[model samples]
Target: MFASPAYAQAAGAAGSSSGSTIFMLGQFVLIGVIFYFLLIRPQQKRAKEHRATIDAVKKNDVIVTAGGIVAKVVKVDETEVEVEIAPNVKIKIVKATIADVRTAGAGKPAND
Candidate 1:
């Protein structure tokens, strides 16, 4: 019931060389395209949206940091921002660390 190693390898390689190598190369490209669309494309889109969100932040905007701290923007600089976490308590954080920017009416009580 046992086959020699050399015989087994030759049996496996027998029909494989009859196939077009171009088809194998095309399969790799197809996989690359699928990966780009399913993985890399969405990542790039999210990165673009995040860039737009970070760029639109302004003074008085409420922001949540990547660290999950909520703060009010006090100043906007090229690469950093000053935010007020509490009354008279301000901290400087890098712009890239901001995770979210709240809309105009966000965080305010609706009925008031």
Candidate 2:
């Protein structure tokens, strides 16, 4: 027979392979931690702040809707708001559609 015989790996090589596997798993865990701190945590914080702002909305507050319409809050209900986009022109909108709220006197003059 001209074929060469195959030899099995030494027992010590098995231990090194297991050590490398643990190191690889540790690397994945570290990456997951980095992603949570850099990406996931901040997003959740922003969502919480946005929810608070929406909940604090009341009559006379100026709001910008998700559709980019700027209006004054005429009435605030549990899940909806009545906004006056123009004098005597009001529309009911979902509270969640409000993107930003500007309380009275918070507006600065165009010159400023």
Candidate 3:
């Protein structure tokens, strides 16, 4: 019962501080934009370029497989390919298993 009117003034300041909820939401949105540009966008672009390279593969291309086998393309179809790894040995593998392609100008490998 001895409290003065200053207690009522402090309660008014506390009510206004709750208005910063909008500022907190803006901060979260800013962080999300930064993460997308710095991390997510680059990863997606690299994956898209890699997919384009894989889809453009043709016959006579030299390629390295995921299993570390280097071979020359003997035949190519929609989803599978025949790769000649040795003089007379050819193995059939799925197209998705190819990890890297050696361009024509890269020169003939030692084994070719």
lDDT (tens digit, per residue) of candidate 2 on 31-95: 99999999999999999999999999998888888998888888999999998887788899999
Residue pairs with backbone overlap in model 1:
none
lDDT of 2 at 46: 99
Worst lDDT run of 10 residues, candidate 2, spans: 1-10
Better of 1 and 3 by lDDT: 1
TM-score winner among the candidates?
A: 2
Model 2, residue 61: distance off in Å is 0.4
Candidate 1, residues 3-112, lDDT tens digits: the string is 69879898888868657576888899999999999999999999999999999999888889999888888899999999888878889999999999996557621222
Stretches of candidate 2 exceeding 4 Å from the true structure:
1-15, 108-112
Cα distance off (Å), candidate 1, residue 63: 0.4
Task: Summing lDDT over every window of 10 consecutive residues in candidate 3, give the lowest-scoring window.
Answer: 103-112
lDDT of each: 0.86, 0.86, 0.84
